[model samples]
Target: MSIAEQFPYKIELHVHLDGAIRTETIVETAKRRNIHFPWETIEELKTHLVMSAPPYHLGALLEKFHTFMPVVAGDRDAIHQIAYEFCEDCKKHDVFYTEARYSPQLFANKMSDGSKPPYAHTEGDITPREVVNIICNAFEKGSQDFGVKVKSILCCVEHAPEWSNEVLELCKEFKPRGVVAIDIACGDLDPDVPHKELHTRAFQLAAQYGIHRTVHAGESGPAAGVRLALDEMHAERIGHGYKVVDDAELYERCRRENIHFEVCPLSSVKTGSVPDDLDKHPLHRFINDEVNFSINTDDPIVLDNDLTSDYEMVMKMGLDKEHVIATIFHAARSCFAPPEEKKQILAELVKVYGEKYMKM
Candidate 1:
């Protein structure tokens, strides 16, 4: 059997909703929304959207979001369609459960007061809160229709800490609707952003109120960012935390705490976060030390990959089937689903992969 077939069940903790929109969906949505862009055909769009080469930095990769985001952003139907389709796509990859994260602000075109502009190109009445509502509604229908469990992590953009408070509130408001956590995504870790305090305060509130927290740190930035996330934000997990290996003390602390790392192998190389040489990847050290980490496809639409692609890359990096099975269990344990849902997921995983693989 193929590697993917051998591991029939899988779980992913880090993927972006905006970054995973179907190319066909983009094409159809753009045409309906009357949005204009460079590429119209799917093949041409792939050439523009897919990052086929390595050594590209995170900022350059993120800029690509603007290219198509305007097409679906703020359109209620488009938002619902994409969220629902995401569940279907997850099922296609044999992913039984996944958490897709995105900044609601980026998908909104106006503020709560019906303001003129937000992140999308055209201004409209859609607000970030409304965006969440739409996605949650669609996720409910999609999960039932597609037979895949999908949840969301609302993001606090690093550059827009002002939005962090509302993001926290949204997490609290939508917890029952599959909104499991709040995360900080996008932008570099710059000290000069005076309003960065907003993110910290919001994260603190999230902790007090029991919201699961994850931060995007130490991917392309320094390991110090990872320390900041833990110290200030109370992050239970780190996103793309490859650089944590740079600090011996912090790495030891993380391993000791069993802090989960959402490791995206192909994305690490594609974003120039790790060396192109697979042998020199930080994941090797993670495996040797048995650190708590899970494999994921960070942005399949942009990276031109899927869960299968990430699994295949790790296998090519010398991981055997047993290691693959272990990571699935790692993800299942680290996921932010509520107690009973998490229990059910764990039971299903053990039933498929066997109890022997759980402790690995």
Candidate 2:
């Protein structure tokens, strides 16, 4: 076996639960419900889930989700099945820890607008907290069955600050129930977000309640957006902060502040956040400067990736084995677990990876 394959211990800190749903599971769920799919076979269905070769713009990547979400709309059991399978997949990969995130508010009954008619397929009548419970329960069950420590994060969208207040409460209520953090993903600092004020307030309140906070920035947005997410939003970590490397000063600021990056190389390549040139990627700078980072599958199934491929890609890009090990520990330190628990995980990793390679 190759070094990457033989090497054990992995932690994926930036994976999206909704985006990583198994395409087969999706097909089965749709078939069980008698929902029509354009593709009759799973092989054909993958073409829709995975993005095409170049020009992987973030907007186009996000549009792919619309194809699947509607298939299981309003079906709590289907959501549970996906979540359970995510854990099983993690176990197959030998992933020791995960911080999987999903937007519970998206599962709730989407209210209709005054001008437009009600949507035909709605996850109707489901309360936001109910959505949280359904997702959390499945992760908790998966954790017990697969022996993978799972931490769930409640995701808030950039354009729906009005919905964040309920999300804040959900984070607080489910903290002990597997919801460890709250995050904003998708876009960054869009003017269309009517409830920016509400979003600011919700994040502040969540911090007070001891909920961990992260934000998706610097991927498709500029470096300044990452600064805003950190300075104004007080985010502990930045998801896909690829553009931060554009500003040397800001990149230095991240290193100084101990803000870790949940770097997903394949997703970056597929999303066009980084150029196709591996040598030009910011991760090299992050590795050389000793900045903390973690290799992750941002959307494993959606992007046709996994933790092993992420680790393998870094090695293919010439990242030293020692540095690759550092990234793994960096991810472990940022797992949203308490200090004591985090220390325990790090110690176990040291034993597995050998004390010589650890940053400690």
Candidate 3:
């Protein structure tokens, strides 16, 4: 049987909202908005949007965003449609629950101070705060309509520390709505780049004010980045943390502390974060040592994968069906949903997969 057929229910914690936008949405939005997009058809656009080959570096994948983000950024209708469609896509992928993450500032055409936006072609009335509100509203409606629980994680761009404080505030304001966590996403995790003070302060305050934290570290960077995420950022989970295995002491510390590593098998290869050879994947150590981790698709649009694609990648890497089930439980336990909602999610998982898989 196929992995999706075997495990029809799943939980995903590390997918990016911007990275998962539908190609059709981009093409349509570009034409509707008169954005002068060069690619007219979905098939043609995907050749540029999707990373089917490599250099396979993180920077190359991020460059894919520049192609379509400008088309949708700063547009209210486009933002709402993507968030709503994301919920439907989640249900199609059998993702019962998900925490879709993105940088709200990237979606807005203008900053609160009347400055230009990052990805938009021109500045306009929409602010980062408004972007959050739109996504929250869309997610709430989409969840009810699609029968999939979707939450948002506001991201602090690694290169743009200036926006970190506002990202924190947005997380706080929308916590009761649909927002659940704060993450440091985007930009390359270059080891030489000095950690920004503003980013650190925001995360520290996030912890102080009880906002859940996750950081994208140790994917392409060194294991020290993972250590910094745990120490300074107080990350509850590490996103795409494949390199932690390189440092035995740090890896052991993570295992002892039960820090959840969001593993993305296809993405790791697509972005060249891991070796091209699946047999030499660090996930083998993670499985053998019984470290706490969960499988995920980091960027479906760019990597040309969904939840099932990631599951099949790992299954082909020698993981059994039981191992796949355990990761779903790990995601459930590590998700940023409120205690009551989390309980319901766990109960549903048990209902579908049974109590025995919980022990695996």
Candidate 4:
């Protein structure tokens, strides 16, 4: 059978909730709030959010964040809409199970007027408790309505180290409601960003509370960032460790430790974090080294790709069908679910695709 007919694939470990907002949904939400978006068309919206030229400097990042912020803010209805829509999209992509991450604290606030905020607001301005509730409720509803399962991971912004504790505290409270992990996201440019100090505290707290830990590293920075994430931050999984190939030792350490790299192929290429050419992606090196990793579309809406398309990219890069199935199973193994649940999902995947495609 062709890969498309493989029926089902059982995992997606890396997806950003805010980044998955549909372009038209953003436009509609903005219109409802009387907030004027800069773009005239959905295509323009997609470009503004995902396809813009970038070294992804602070200015560009802020601009992109501002564009999507309105869609997620305001009342619980907006949050529910975006979250439910995300699950719908996941079902379409055949993502049986997923771990979706976002900074819930960032989604708080209503538009006072059409004008933008003069400066970024710290976590002090928003109630973390309310943000977590909004996110958890949406995820609960999505599962009930669509039969697609998801686990929410509260993500702390790396640039805002001061808010790390508050974010972790919120994650602790939401753990009973299916919030499974905590992550540190945002760019990794400044060498002295205090990622070590901040993530260390959060990781320790998560460990104490028995929640999983992950962090974004090496996507936009050097290979050393990946090492720091593992060594200093105690990250259980590394999000987009694209530069791991640059450090043989770190790559080996990840393989030995069984640390999963949530590699977002489309996002990496679109954001210029990886080479524009798919063939040049460090994923090839990861495959050769047998490093533990999984494919994801970091921002399906923004990157204009999905899990299926990500898999197709791997195939296009000449990974054979066996490797493709193995890659899918690798992703299933990396998910944040409990061990028993993961085992069940893995079995289901094997039953569906393994036997038929194993020798391909």
Candidate 5:
């Protein structure tokens, strides 16, 4: 039977909030905030958001993405709305659960109207704490409204080490509100910055608070990046760990350590972090090695994909159905949610899929 004919199970672990925002919503929010968008139409804006231009470069692509952020700037309500939309999209893809991450520092600013008090060392603005609250609040509401479980993580953009500390503080403050993990995300083209310094600090802080840690490594960097994140940062999971396949020792280490990799197939292809052809992806090799990993849509908006499409790609690539099921469970095991929560979700997924597809 074809892989799709056998049915597939899925769970997502590494998605970004800003990159997941709906393009239509971006336009609407821009209009509401009186920010002018360069695109004449929503379709054009989406094209830019997804980087449809031939021959993509990470730095230049990110620069283009920043052009749309002003609309979301100083807008807590818009952030909440975007969060809701993200959960709704997850549900549409049959993703029972998701752990979305965002950089709180990016949204830590006063309203465009400048009504609220300013944060320290800046003109009147909100604090990173405020941004975390807004994001968590939205997730709470979305979970309740959609019957789709969702949790969030505060991401520390590795480019700025000073700002990373602020994110760590916010993560500590929001621990009670279901913020379960801390992530370091940014372009890996230039490894000169040494993620170890900040990641080690973040991991130490998370360990102090008993929060889980994950890091974006090995996507566009050398295989050593994966080793550093695992050894130095002590990450519980590696996001977009494409380079691990290139280093047998690191791959073996990951297997021995049972480290989870949050693989985003479409994002890898779009960004040229991996071969565009699905058949060429090393995910099959990882699966065969029994490497614990999960499929995810890193930036659903930019990749125009979700958990369903990610699973579809696996099927299209000829992955075994039984292995797909096993991977989903592996993903559940790797979730940063509390053990009890993970158990409950796993049981629920097994019950549903087992009855529909796995039963003899």
Candidate 6:
């Protein structure tokens, strides 16, 4: 096998739980629930789920999950199974450590307003807290079963002020139970229209309680979105911050603060957040500008990408072996895993990338 194939000791910081659903799980779960999906077979399901190349839509980013909501939004076992399979899939793909995220608001009784995640009726009686516990416990089982390290982060939707507060409370209550940090995700409006009042309150609680902050900014939104997330909510890490390269001041501040960028190259292209053309992607600029970043599969199965594929993509896009390796280390540092776990993964990375392991 080539070095790319043998590339060892991976870490991811930006994968979405719902966005990364396994097609087979989606198919089988839908079948059991009598829920209908557009495709009949796993092979056919991949056509709608995976983004082979770009010219993909932003609506397609989370909108593809409309068919998936019935299973996830309704059932605890379905959520647990999905979380377990996500870790299993990461281990099979050679990821040793990872931080996964999800928005809890989407699950709790979907709304009649403009709010998303249409409520899917469930025969089972389950609250969102129970749902969170089920998902977290399933991650623990998957870690034990697959020998991969996984941590969960909860997201509060940008526009859902009330739900955002509810999700933040969950983050505080579940911090010791494998939920590490809080995130505000999925606002793609212009930078000037800040989603502040409720998000700020939630983040203040995070600060008081020691929950780390990661935010989705500068994605489909402009570079100013990155600055707003920091200024308004104190974002410690940015998800899909390619637009930071477009603004010199933000670039300099990110470098000085050691703010990590969770760069999901494939998702960037597919969501129209960055260019469809890989060569034109600002990952090159992030490299040139010395911004801290970690390559990630924002949605693995959905985008037809995993950590290894992203490693190959970056290498082909002009990153050398050292940068390719550094990205993993960057993720290790920025990951929400415990300090000792972080140390172990870093040591393992050194051992694998070191001459001793390579020679062996």
Q: What is candidate 3's lDDT per residue for 188-281, written digit by digit as tens?
A: 4444566577887899999999999999999988888898888988889999889998999999999999999988888888788898877889
Candidate lDDT scores, in order, read: 0.89, 0.80, 0.90, 0.74, 0.74, 0.78
Off by over 4 Å in 1: 113-118, 188-193
Q: After superposition, how far is residue 167 of candidate 6 from its true place, in Å?
A: 1.1
- For all predictions, the C-alpha RMSD in Å is 1.4, 2.4, 1.1, 4.0, 4.1, 3.3
Clashes of each: 0, 0, 0, 0, 2, 0
Candidate 3 ranges with C-alpha deviation above 4 Å: 188-192
lDDT (Cα, 0-100) at 332 in candidate 1: 94
Candidate 1, TM-score vs. the true structure? 0.97
Judged by lDDT against the true structure, how good is candidate 1? 0.89
- Candidate with top lDDT is 3
lDDT value, residue 55 of candidate 6: 55
Sort order, TM-score high to low: 3, 1, 2, 6, 5, 4
- lDDT by residue (tens digit), candidate 6, 1-360: 765466767888888888888888878887887776678899998887676655576677666667666666756678889899999888888888887898765654444232444445643345556667888899899999999988889988776667777788789888888898888776652455555677777887787788888888888878888887788777788888878888998888898998999998778878888776777898988788666889988877678777788887888899988787777777777888778877788778888876332211
Shift of residue 27 alpha carbon in model 5, Å: 0.6
Positional deviation of residue 248's Cα in model 2 after best superposition, in angstroms: 2.3
Q: Is candidate 2 or candidate 6 better by TM-score?
A: 2
Candidate numbers sorted by lDDT from highest down = 3, 1, 2, 6, 5, 4
Instruction: Kindly give the stretch of ten consecutive residues in candidate 5 with the minimal lDDT sum.
Output: 112-121
Q: How many backbone clashes does candidate 3 have?
A: 0
Q: Write the per-residue lDDT of candidate 2 for residues 41-78, one digit (tens) a residue.
A: 78888986787675578887887778887776557788
TM-score (all chains, Cα) for each model: 0.97, 0.93, 0.98, 0.88, 0.89, 0.91
Q: List the residue pairs that clash in candidate 3.
A: none
Clashes of 4: 0
- Candidate 6 ranges with C-alpha deviation above 4 Å: 52-54, 108-117, 189-195, 355-360
Query: Candidate 2 has which clashing residue pairs, if any?
Result: none
Q: Tens-digit lDDT track for model 1 on 1-360?
A: 886798789999999999999998999988887887668899999998898865498987898887888788888899999999999998888998999998888888887645544457777778899999999998899899989999999999997777899999999999999999999988545444568789989999999999999999999988888888899989999999899999999999999999999999988987889987889999999999999999999998999998988899999999988888899999999999999999999999989989997777
